[model samples]
Structures are given as structure tokens and as C-alpha cells.
Target: MNRPTLTRVLVANRGEIACRVMRTAKAMGMTTVAVHSTIDRDARHSREADIRVDLGGSKASESYLNIDKIIAAALSSGAQAIHPGYGFLSENAGFARAIEQAGLIFLGPPASAIDAMGSKSAAKALMETAGVPLVPGYHGEAQDADTFRAAAERIGYPVLLKATAGGGGKGMKVVERESELAEALASAQREAQSSFGDSRMLVEKYVLQPRHVEIQVFADQHGHCLYLNERDCSIQRRHQKVVEEAPAPGLTPALRQAMGESAVRAAQAIGYVGAGTVEFLLDARGEFFFMEMNTRLQVEHPVTEAITGLDLVAWQIRVAQGEPLPLTQAQVPLNGHAIEVRLYAEDPDNEFLPATGTLALYRESNPGPGKRVDSGVAEGDSVSPFYDPMLGKLIAWGEDREQARLRLLSMLDEFAVGGVRTNLAFLRRIIGHPAFAKAELDTGFIPRHQAELLPPPTPLPEAFWQQAAQAWVRTQPDQGLWTSGNGLRLGLPAETVLHLRSRDQHQVVHALAATDGQGIRQGETVYVRWEGEVHGVSLFDPIAQADASHTTQGGLTAPMNGSIVRVMVQAGQSVEAGTALVVLEAMKMEHSIRAPAAGVVKGVTCQEGEMVSEGSVLVEME
Candidate 1:
């Protein structure tokens, strides 16, 4: 078949994936067009593109997820093809169909293929018909609580409820018993509806101690399909993958071939084209069962690329242009071990709630042969609450798993982000854990080792105080012997008392006139990096300290910036501690604001549908 004239391509997404795809497309000599929401007008992806289209909305529903807007952007930009870089509308069958109807190439599977596997329930049914082993559960079209309750009871306790229309742990919940079934189902459905515009759900048996292993499959229009080995994405939090490694650690050659072939068969069943991932729940005793199929490039694709030395994005483009598979199944290469960790702007200590703020100080790890940092934001960029909290990804490749793991640790240590809290330290602890080093991985890895990985905050050491003092001293105007402001006397070096504050802790450090330490001063705050950790230290001010000391003893506040989706408390209602008072939706996830102590609700400061900022009191108790 003659190659389709594909000189221009438009990316129908934003953030790291958009930047990632545009880089590959530009490298392939194609003009790249970027579509962005109003808030992302100056985003990295928009700036890097050869052409830009403004979709004109901050929320995804009005921009990225709007099929009409994306298609219009592609048409106006005169792009020949549209690449739906995963998330948003990547797996939406309607989006694929719209692109096809608009006379443009969709750099993904056929619309029919996506429609077949878009719904987890439908995908499982198709997998069963293809003779792929499945975990026993109910995947029928039933949204009622009673149906799910019955299914859970029949499938035994501990079931996983998932959104049929999407992945990414957005609409997924694990119910441990029958009593938790109704609430879990309702919450899962709400998240599903908000994310995919579909409230349909499926209940499946929660596999005990199962490893999440997935195979990357690729195909062209000519019916040639092959699996590009597997990745173990077992290290997860909240059902979202945290760490992923290529070529699952303990799989034998025979087992690898078996899973790979099964994944290929599953893909062929739907006439899948372009890139897709077939996920499975692998248990001890070599048993693996199909979980679902993601009909788009996965977030963890970098690990597969690292091990295979293949640019999956470039392949997606070529395949979309009607080319055949680049290599046969036997010719596929698996060279070395590779690992990837997601860098999310979230506070792990606060139940991993997403954080939003300015990127006061952003520094990526030094580029090298084996290290790669794929990020979308730069220093001074704002991390808004309107999108995913992930800032970027850190990927490392090495000759062995240990080398790859250590390299990733070093990379995480070198990485630093300020203003917004992040999971960088948590990721480092996970990678550096002895259990992870031994490859004792599973879906429960984070929860199992939570004590060590999520340890309580320790008091800042004296060395850190000294460093802060030195950093502060460098900011002084005068540095001469006679005019210095370092408590300078006639001859003796006098101690300068420096009052500093970090978070809620106040410190008083005394230091002599000395040189600066490793720190970056941003505004009134100084960020000091010590032993792989970044500490934000601010000079103590009486007024600011007094303002911070104002107590909210009986107030329940929003933990992050989001819209209030539900208010479960009234002004005069009484509640107990831990009672869910309000549900705030942010970054596509819901966070419940619970009552701090048993008391009567004195006031409901926030109403449903109101947008609130972090620390905004939602409910006042008395």
C-alpha cells in the first residue's frame, strides 16, 4: 500500500504525553500541531508545537474531552492525522469515530476496535470469547446497587468495582465486604460518570496478592499483530501504577511467550491496530487471568521502549500511515532492564491529595545515556488544579535490574520541585526499599510496606539549620568587614541569630559570617537541598507567624483546590469525628472533608458546586 500523505499531525491532548508525542512527530519530519485549553495557552506542549490551536476552556469537558472541539482544531490546523495521547479522549470510541468521519487518520486502533475494548465489561466478554483466561466476576450491564451486591456475594467477598468506559484507576474501587459494596459502587459510578460520561460499571473478584502484568501489543491495518514483551506494573497506590519495569522479573521464557501470545490473540480478536495493552492479574503458581485491555499507549510505555530500544510513538505514526509491522515477532528485541516512576505533584502524607501551585523551583535530573526525564512544566510554571497532578516521569535503563533501580534512585534524588508538594521522596523510598530491590513486587507493595515508605516526618537536623542560616546570610546586602550586616564588630567574628521557619516548625540558628550553601532563593523562601531532600525554609516574621497560628479548631477545610460536589452536613446538624461532611472533586478525583471532632455543625461555609481553595474552611463545627 502506498504511504498516506501525512505531513502534519495534531495532538489532541496536553501535558507530558502531548510533549512526548510531538517530539517523536517532529523528529520524523512531520509538522506538529498542539491543541490546548485556555489555561494551557503557554504550556510546554503548545509552545513546542509547530502550530497551536486554542480550545478555550480550563475544564477537560469543554476542551480535550470535547470531540467536536478536538476535531475542529485538527481541521483548522490542516493536520492530516490526530494523535490522541492517552487519557482524556484517547480511548473514547466516539472520538476515534469522529476523527475517521472528519477525513483524518487516527493514530490508534480502529473505532470498532476501541468500541469493542473500551468498556471493561465488554472487553472481558470478548476476551472470554477469545479463550483468554478471565477472573470470575460479573461484567454484565447492571448499574443498580443490588445487582453489584449480588455479584459480590456470589463472587465471594472482596470485589473490585471498575468503570466500564475508562482506566487509570479513576473509577476503580476495591470493596472488602458486602457492607462496603453500596457506597463503593456509588462512588465508583460518580467518578466514572465524571471521567468518561458513563456510569456503567462492572464487579470483579479482587485477586489476592496478584501482580499486575501487562503486555504491549502493536498491529497495523494489514492484520499483523505482535506483543512487545511485558511490564510488571505491580507497584501501585490507589490502584494506579507507581513503578513499572519491563520484562517482569520472575517470568520464565515459556511463561513470557504464553502471556505474549495470549495478548496477541486478544488483540487479534478485535482487529486491534496501533498500540494497545492487555492487562492481566498474575498470581502465584503461574496462573494469570485477563483483567482488561487499554486501547491506547500506556503511561508506563517508557519502560517498554527502554528495554526494546524502539520508539513506540514513532511506530504509532508509521502504522497509522498504513505501514506494516516493522519487525516480526521473533525479531523483537529485549535488551536490558528498565524502570519508570511517575512524578506526581501530590502530598503523599495527606492521603496523596493532588497539590496545585506555582513551580517555584523546578530542576530535572542531569541528562545522561541511561536517564530520561519527560516533563511538561518548567520553572515558574503553574500547576493548576484543573488537570492531572503528574508533573512528569523519570525513566532509567541499565544492563540489569539492580543497576536500573539504583540509577532511578539517583535520578529521583537529583530531581527537585518546589511550591507544590510531590511524591518524589515517597518514590525514592519505594525504589530504595529492600523489598523492591529483591523484586518482591505486587499490587499491594505500597500498602504492605507503608510503614517504611511513608514514615512520619522527622525534625530537621542541625546541619539543615546551619545550611539555612548560611543561605540566609548570603542574601545580606553588605559583605565587607566594616559594613557587613553579619553582626560584625571591630575584629571578632560574631554570631548572627537567624530565625527560620519550615512548615509548622520554628528554629533559631546562630552562625558566623560564612559563604552560602546549596540553596535556591525564591521570593521570601529559600529552598535548601540536603541528602536528596529539598526543604523550603522561610525567614521568621512575627506577623506571618501570628497569621499562621490562627487556629481552625472546629473547622473542616478543603485540603486542595476543587469544586464542592456534595455537602453531607447541614449548619445545625451534629456529627461525629471522621464523618464525611463534604466531597471535593479535584484533579478528577474526589476527596472527602471529614469532621475533625464530634460537634454540632455551626455553619456550612461552602455550598455544592462552589470552588474552594486549599485551607478554605468548608464546614464549621462547635
Candidate 2:
């Protein structure tokens, strides 16, 4: 077969994955084109591309998921290929066919291969023919709630409801009891319809204490396939992977071989090409079952690349060009351990609800040697609620698992994002947890250590106050009636006291100016290193700020950034404490806003389908 020339490739997606793909393609000397939504014209990925085309819509359906827009962008840019960097349209078999029909190379698997693995029901049946072990479940044609509920009963309690066409943990729910079956089924179906355009579902016997291990498989058109070891994605929240590492810890060599060979067999049966992942659920008995196959590069692919010293995206391009696999299965090396954690815009104290705001302060960890940060947004960019809330990924590699874990923790400490809530602290707690340090792995790792992971309020040290005071003192004019007299009672010439705010709490501390070291300045804030720890302090006008930390009981407000999906009560309606009032949907998940106390609804401030900011009042009660 003649190799296809990929002079230029259009990335038909947005955010970090697009940035990730562009980095490798540019390094390989290929022209890259980025197709962005209406709101993403100023995005980092668009600016990083050799050429960028506007997709002309803010939402996914009208832009990223629109096959015609992406195709037109590629053709207009004179690109010969399209790289659907995971998420939006990466796994869509129809999009792959459209690319092929346009005589353009799709830098992914063939449409046939995607079709074979797209649907859970069909994929499970196909795996049976391929002699691959699968989890016990009902992957039949019946799509009614009654049928699914009955199937769950047959599978016993704790059945998992999953969207047949869903990935990235969307449209998936765990029904722990019969009473929870109906609501879970409806929610899963609604999410499936919203996300995948298909509401068909499948029921599975939920495995207990299972480790999520997935094999990275690569294939070429000329009949070659290989597995690049395995990644342990067991540490998860809301069914989405949080921490991923290569060469799953505690896996015996024999078990690794068994899983890898099984993954290869599964790929061969589908005539797979390019990069793909076969996920599995492994139990305590060393038994494994096929979960699902992601027919595109995974979000956690960097960990696999870090361990193998190979670029999977480059391989995808080469394979799409009809080239042969670079190496055989025997040559695949798992040199060292690597770990990656997703950095999301979320509030851990508020149930990890997604947060969106202007990144007023953002500074990434410095990358050198084994530390890598793949991001799509820089400081001053807006994190909109229209897409995924992930800021980026932080990955670190070391000689061993412990080294990698410790190195990643240090790197995370160096990372900072402000003007919005983030899960950075939560990630630190997880990696530093005792069980995590001991390599005690399972799917329920997060919930198992939830108590230890939540932050307990601790008072700021005196050095932190000194750090803030130094920065604030420098910003102030030397001699002024208002500024010079901003101290405590009976204060002498040398007496200095500063009132400040840290993480939304008011602080009054005594801090004298220190003429020691320099502090790093970010925006209007200063980050100072004290006692071997970095502390960030920003000056705020006392008159402009309202102290709401103590008085949080006036009206029900939006807990995070989201749109009002539903309003359960009306104005003048009577409601008791804990009564549900409104539903907010953010990051593709729904959360109810309930009444704080028994009262009459004075008014409903927010209506359905309206976007609300964090802390925006939604309902007022009296």
C-alpha cells in the first residue's frame, strides 16, 4: 500500500487534547489547523495552530460535533487529514466515515472498527465471538425502564446503568438498591440522550473493590497490533478517572501478559487501527472482564507515553498514512513508573461541583526532566461552563512508583489557579493519603478515603501574615494620612498591623516589614516562600469587600457555576427545610438547591434555562 501524505492535519476538537495533538504534530513538522467554537477564537489551542478556522458556534453540537463544519475547516485549510482529539467527535463512527467519503485521511480507526466498538450492546456481543471475557450484564434490545429494572433485579442489588454509546463516565450510574433503580435509570437515560443522541442503556452487575486497568493498543492497516502495557485508573470520582499511572502497581507479570494478549485479540477482532484503549475491571481473585473500548486516544494517554518513551499521537498519524507498526510486541518497554492527575475547576468543599470564571491568576508548574504540564488555557483566559471543566493535566515520571507519586505531589504544590475554585488541594490530599502511599488500589479509592481527603480548617501561620504584609506594604504610598495611619490602637512608630483576606476569610495580624527575600508577583498578588512553603497574598479594599463567611443564610444561591435546569417551587409557595427548590446543571451533572429552613418562598429569582454564576441568588425565602 502507498503511504498517504499528511502535509497538514486539522484538529477537530478543543482544549487540552487539541493542544496535546498539535504539540506532537508540530514537532513532526506537520502543519496543524485548529477548529474552534465562536467563544474560543482567542483560545490557546487556536493560537498555537499553524492555521485556525472558526467553527462559528459556541455549543458543541453546532461546532465541535458538527461533522460538516469540521470537514469544511479541513478542506478550506487545505489539510489532508483530521485529528479528532478525544471527546467531542473522536469516537463518532459517522464522522470517520464522512472524512473518508471526502477522500481525507481520518487520523483514527476505520469507521468499521469504530462502529464495531461504539455500542455497548453490540460490542459485548462481538467480544463474545472473539472469546474475550465480559462482565455479566444485560446488553439486550429492550430499552424501557421496566425492562432495565427487571434486569437489575436479576443481576441483584448494586447494578450499574450505563449508556450504550457513552464514554468519559457520562450517562453512568450505580443503583445500590431497588428503591434507587427508577431515578438512576431515568437520569442515566436523560444524560445519554443529552450527550450521545442515544438513550439506549445496558445493565451490569457492579463489581466490588475492582481496579480499573486499561491496556493501550495500537494497530496498523497492514495487520499489526500491540499493547503498550497497562494503566491503573482506579482512583476516580463520579466514575471519571482522576489519577492514572502506567504499569499498574501490584500486577504480576503473568497477569499483565494475560490482559495485554486479551486486548490484542479484542483489537484484531475489530480490525482496529491507530490508538485505542481496552478497559477492564479486575477483581481480587485476579480475574478480569472487558469494560469497554475507547476507540480513540484516552485523556490519560500521556502516562503511557511517559512510561514507554514513545509518542502515541505520532503513531496514530503514521498508521493513518498506511505505515507499518514501528515495533513488535516484544519490543514494547515499560521502563519506569509515571503518574498523571487531572486539574479541574471545581469546589471540593461543595461536592466537587464544577466552577467557571476568568482565570484571574494562573501559573503552571515549571516543567523539566520528568515533570510535564499539558494545558490549553493560560492566565486571563475564561473558563466557560459550555465545555469540560478540566484546566489541564500534571504528569510526573520517576524511577519508581513512590518517586513518581512524591514528585507529582511536589509539582502540584507549585501549581496555582485563582479567581475560581479548584481541586488542587483535594488532589494533594489524595496523593498524600496513607492508603495511596501504600499502593492500595481500587475503584472506590476516593470515597474510601473521603474523610481524610476533605480539608479541615486550619489557622494561617504567622509567616503567612508576614508574607502578605510585606507585599501590601510595598504597594502602599510611603507617606499619607489614610495609608500611614492604617494601624492598631496605641500604635507607636514601629508598630505595624495589617488587616487582610485569605481564601475569603478576614484576618487581622501584626506583621512588620522584612527586608529579606524577593516574592513572586502574579497579577495583583504576591507569592512568598516562607518556612519552605509558598503562600499567596493579595490586597483587597476593605470598603469593596463584604464578609459573607459568617452570614451565609439570607437566600438560597447557586453553589457553583451552572445553568438552571429546573425550578421546583414558585413565588409565595410554602416550603419546609431541606425542600428542593432548584436544580443546577454544571459540568454535565445535576445538583439540587434546597431550602435552608422552613419558610415561605418570597420569590424565585432564577428561572429554568438561565445561566447563573457562583453564589448568584436563585430563590429568596421569608
Candidate 3:
């Protein structure tokens, strides 16, 4: 049968994944159409496309996840194919079926395969029947409190409650004891419903000291399928992967071949085409259990491409156009090592909370040979609260593991972000850890090194204060007379006072100059190098709070820009320390605001389902 050509493609996604797919599609000479939300009209991915379609909403449900809007955009843009890039509607079987029924190419596995593995419970049951090794768990169809509780009891304590249709760690909770099971299950189900529209959960025994390994499998319509090695995604936080590396550090030839073959068998059994990842939990005894399979291209696919020199996006498009597999399993090349880190716009010090602000100073690492930076936002762009907080990805490839590791570390150092808190420094620590260097990996990697990874807060040094003073001087025309051309102050010591802030700490220091000799200004920020270290400080303009309506002397305020999902306590309610008062959700993660002390709630100012600003008072305590 002759297949229709796919020359024009519409990417039905947003952010870095959209940009990544567009790059490959454009390189393949296909016209790329980008569908964007109202908030992302000027985003990097929107600008990367040949033609843009406005989805006309700020939220994911109103825009990207709306199958009708995506289909209409593809049809109106004169595109012949649609690529669902990794999230949102990528794993939605109904969306895939709609695209195919509309006479457009769906650049992924068939809707049948998507349905086969769409839910954790369904997928596990199917995998068990296929003779694939599965972790001991309950994949029952009944979705009730009593049923789940009984299942958890049978599975034993310390089980994991995972949303049946979850990805990216949204609907995952670990219940260490019997008492924690109820809250964990409820939160997991709520998050699962909010994110994936499925609240049904599956309970599984939590594995100890297990490495999260996944095999990259590709298949074509002509009965050709092969595995593209594997990736180690053991380093994770909050059930989401933070770092990934290709050719898992210490896999024996026999074990590697077995896993790869098993992944291929799994894909073939479902007639899966395009890119997919078969995840497995590797234990300390070298035993493995099948985890849920992701039927879409993974966020960490770049490492697989870097090591194999294969563009999985291009492969997806080609396979959708009825092309045969580009290479056989024997012909697949496994070259040098590659490592990737997901840089998120989040405050790791603040319990890994998502941060929202403009990218006042977003500088990406230079993408030299074997170095790649895939990002969706540029400098001056706003990091909104409507979506995931992942800012971009940094990937590096080198001749050896050490070379890759060292190069990645240098690239991370060069990558800078401003105007918002990020996990940049924390990522550096993970890569620099001695255990990481020696390839000691597991799901507990981050928790084991929490003290080293999350260092105690230290006060800013004198140099930081000095730099702030110098920056303040340069910004003031009247103060310029006090400093020399070389950034040194000719005036007396403590001639000026500097009010500076870092993260949330405000400091007042009396200093004269930013430096003793030299300094440079970039935009509103000034950089000073002293004592063999360079410090960059931005002039802080504190808002004059005339009314203070958003703040209370003794009140709990909203910690971020999010909606109040729940109010656990009401007005005049007595609460003890650590008692949850309100629950706030932002970027798909839930944060509970607890009572600061044993006190009576004077009033409840916020209500459930209402959007609140960062500093709006939620409840007052007296």
C-alpha cells in the first residue's frame, strides 16, 4: 500500500519539547506549525514554527489539551501530520484517535497501543499476562476507599499509591505507615484527577534501593522494532527525574541484552510504533521488575539521540509516513557517554517550590560540539504559574563518562538564571557528589545525600554587600561623584548604606564602593569580581506598602501564586503547630500551609477554588 507523504507537521504541545520537535521537523524539510496558548504567543517554540496557530487561552485545558483546537489548528495550517511532544495530550488515546480520524498523521504509537498502556492498573495487568516481570501490586478495577485500603494491607505497609493514569510524578505518594495511607491516597487521587482526568489509583509495594532504568524502543509499521540502549534516571526529586544519563553506568552485556529484548517484546506485543520507553526498577541484587511504560517520547530522549546519533523526532515522523526502521538492532551504534539535567525554575531551598517571575537574566551555556541546550523561554520572558516549572534542559556528550560529567558541570556553571529562584546550584551538587561520580545510583540517591545536597544557609559575604553598594552608586547619578572610574570609591569608609536582598533575606550594609578597583554593569545588575570570586547583584526596588492589605502581622499568607484547593480549618478553629490550615496547588504540586503555633484562627480570609497572589493572607491566627 502506498503511503501519503508527510511534508507539513503541527506540533500539538508547548515549551522545550515543542521546540525540540520543530527543530528536527524543519531539518527534515517539513513545514512546522506551532499551536500555542495565549501566554506563549511570543515564546521560543511559537517563534520557531513556520506558521503559528493561536489556541486562545492561558491554561493547558483551555488550549493544548483541547483536541478540537489542536485538530482545527493542524487543518487550518495545511499540515498533514501532528506531533504530540511528550506531555499533555501525548498519551491521550482519544486525542490520537481524533487526529487519525481527521485524516492527519499522528506521529506516535497507535491509539490502540496508547489505550493498552494508558493506565497503570490496566498496563500492569496486561504486562503480567504477557509474562513480563512485574512488581507485586494490586491492579484491580474497583476504585473505592475500602478496596484500596484492603489492597494496601495485602501489599503491606510502606506501599506507593500511584495514579493509574499518571506521569511526571504528579499522582504519586509514598505511604510509610498505615496512618499515612489515607492522606497519601487522597492527595494522589486528587492530583491524578486534576492532571490526568483519572483519579483511579494502583497500590504497589515500595521497592528499596532500586535504580530507575528504562529502555528506549522504536518500531515501524513494517514489523521492524529495536531497542536504542537504555537511560539511568535514578536521580529524582518529588518523583520527577532531575538528571539522566545514557548507557546506564554498570550494566553487564547479558543483562543489558535481556532488558532490551524484553522491551522490544513488550512493544511488539502491543504493535507499538514510534518512540516509547519501557521503565523497570533494578534492585541491588540485579533483579528487575517492570514499571509502567510511557507510550510517548520521553523528556530524556536527547541523551539517547546524543549517544546513537539518531534524531528520534525524525524517526517518529518517518515511521508515521510508513517508512521502514532506519537501522537494525545489530547496526545500532552506541558511541560515547551523554548526560542531561533538567533545569527547573524552582526554589530548591524552599522545599522545591515553583517560582514565577520574568527571566531578567537568562543566559544559556554555549552549545559547542556535543553540547546542547534545549529551552522554551528566553531572557525577559515570564515564567508563568500555569504550567510545569521546567525551564529547559542541559545536555553534554563526551568521549568518556568523566569527560561527559566534567563538561556537563562546566556547562551548568555557565548557565545562569535571574529574577527567580532555581535549582541550578542544587543540580551542581548532584553532579559533583562523590557517590554520583562512582555510579552509586538508586531512587533514594537524593534523600541519602540531602544534607550534602541541601547545605545549610550561609550569610552573604562582605563582597556581596560591597557589590550591592557599588551597584547602587552606579545607578544614582548623585552618588557617582563618590566613586572612581575603576569602581573604587574615593570617599570615606561607610559613606553609603546599601539595602540588598537575596532570595528572601534582606540586609543593610554600609559600604562605599562595589569594588576596590574594577566592576562591570550588565543591564540593571552589576558584576564585581573580588577575592577570586565574581558576584552579581541586582538593585532591589522595594514596593512602598501603603495599605499592607496583602500582609498581616500574625497571619498565614499564600506562599506562591496558586489556587486554594482546600481549607482544612475554618474561622475560630483551634489548631496546634503543624496542623494544616489551607492547601495550595501550583504547577501541579500541592503545598499545605500549617499553623505556625498553637493558636485560635481569628478569621479565614481565603476560600477554596479562589486564585491567590503570592502574599495574600490566607488565615489569621490570634
TM-score of each: 0.97, 0.92, 0.93
Task: Indicate the TM-score of model 1.
Answer: 0.97
Model 3 TM-score on a 0 to 1 scale? 0.93
Q: List the residue pairs that clash in candidate 2.
A: none
Best first by lDDT, ranked: 1, 3, 2
The better-scoring model by lDDT among 2 and 3 is: 3
Candidate 1: which pairs clash? none
Deviation in angstroms for 19 in model 2? 0.8
The number of clashing residue pairs in each candidate reads 0, 0, 1
Find the candidate with the highest lDDT and give its number: 1
Which stretches of candidate 2 lie above 4 Å from their native place? Answer: 458-463, 474-493, 516-519, 527-536, 540-554, 571-580, 596-602
lDDT of 2 by residue, 1-622 (tens): 8565778999998889999999999998899999999999999999899999999977677788889988988989999999998877788899999999998999999888888898888889998877788888899998888898888888798899999888878889988998878867877887776566778899999988899999999999899999999999999998989999998999999999999999999999988999999999999999999988989999999999999999999999988888899899999988889999999988777777888888867888877789999998998899887788898999999999999998998898888777777888888888888899899999989888877887555677766776677666655544243254455545554436667766665577665544443466665666554432345667656766655324435688888777787788999899999887997777666677888789999888898889888788899889
Per-residue accuracy of model 3 over 1-622 as CA lDDT, tens digit each = 4378778999998889999999998888889999999989998889989999999987677898899999999999999989999878889999999998999889999999998887778889889998988998898888787887888888898898898888999889988887777777888888887777778899999887799999999999998999999999999998899999998999887888999999999899899989999999998777888998899999999999999999998889888888999799999989999999999988776788899988877778877888999899898888887789999999999998989999998888777777777788888889989999999999899999999999776777776676667665656555553655545445545366666655554567676543453444556565443322234565555664235435478888987898888899888889999888898888877888988799999999989989898889999999
lDDT measured at residue 536 in model 2 versus the true structure, 0 to 100: 61
Model 3 global lDDT (CA atoms, 0 to 1) = 0.85
Query: Which portions of model 3 show Cα errors greater than 4 Å?
Result: 467-497, 508-523, 527-551
Q: What is the lDDT of candidate 2?
A: 0.85
Candidate 1: residue 306 lDDT (0-100): 96
lDDT of 1: 0.89
